[model samples]
Target: MSQLTTHILDTSAGIPAPGIAVTLFVLQEKEWLQLAAGITNSDGRVNNLWEEGSSLPHGLYKLHFDTQEYFERNFTASFFPFVEIAFYINSHAHYHVPLLLSPFAYSTYRGS
Candidate 1:
């Protein structure tokens, strides 16, 4: 588990989107600094984005999901090469961001 976590569901296939690469970045003084990166597991979850119980500085953060490779792996044509979700982390509370994706479209939101 981590202070921040994520999962992806392939809405088109109705299954967990495994093997996708996900990256986390924190807004620095003037640029984005990489925080962590991980590949989704069989259940489409990345629970190690950061150390569990670690103190995460409150700031703007981003989650970049690699969609091109995932689409290519399944031989599907996709409109977006990748998906980036920017959010704010302002507290110690757990943050779960989940993505619902398909070949041509995607949606995401804060999750429990």
Candidate 2:
């Protein structure tokens, strides 16, 4: 079975971006449909974006992070209201998407 997970690190504060909302979507036929949603935990991770025994089909997927709310709660000014990471998941393997975030910038990559 395949699994999907994510982590969000607040680079500016040097901590996990806890309680931040994240939504997962699958692109199908030119439209995006919500597959799962989770909030970052104390460790700045969402370990189970998908069910344990479930697997996602090979396709394009996206992770949307609500950076505005996170920044607002921390009383910081942000240039990006939100961050969206779109990537391809092509096999029955675990996908770890980690986000390195700051008030003004963010980056994401495929992790082990």
Highest TM-score: give the candidate number: 1
Error of 2 at 6 (Å): 0.2
Error of 1 at 23 (Å): 0.5
Q: Where is model 1 poorest over a 10-residue stretch in terms of lDDT?
A: 48-57
* Native-to-model Cα distance after best TM-score fit, residue 13 in candidate 1, in Å: 0.5
Residue runs of model 2 more than 4 Å from their true location after superposition: none
Error of 1 at 16 (Å): 0.4
lDDT of each: 0.94, 0.92
Per-residue CA lDDT of model 1 for 62-111, tens digit only, reads: 99999899999999999999999999999999999999999988999899
Model 2, 6-88: lDDT tens digits are 99999989999999899999999999999999999999999988999888999999999988998899899999998999999
Q: Which 10 consecutive residues of model 2 have the lowest summed lDDT?
A: 1-10
Off by over 4 Å in 1: none
Q: Which residue pairs in candidate 2 collide?
A: none
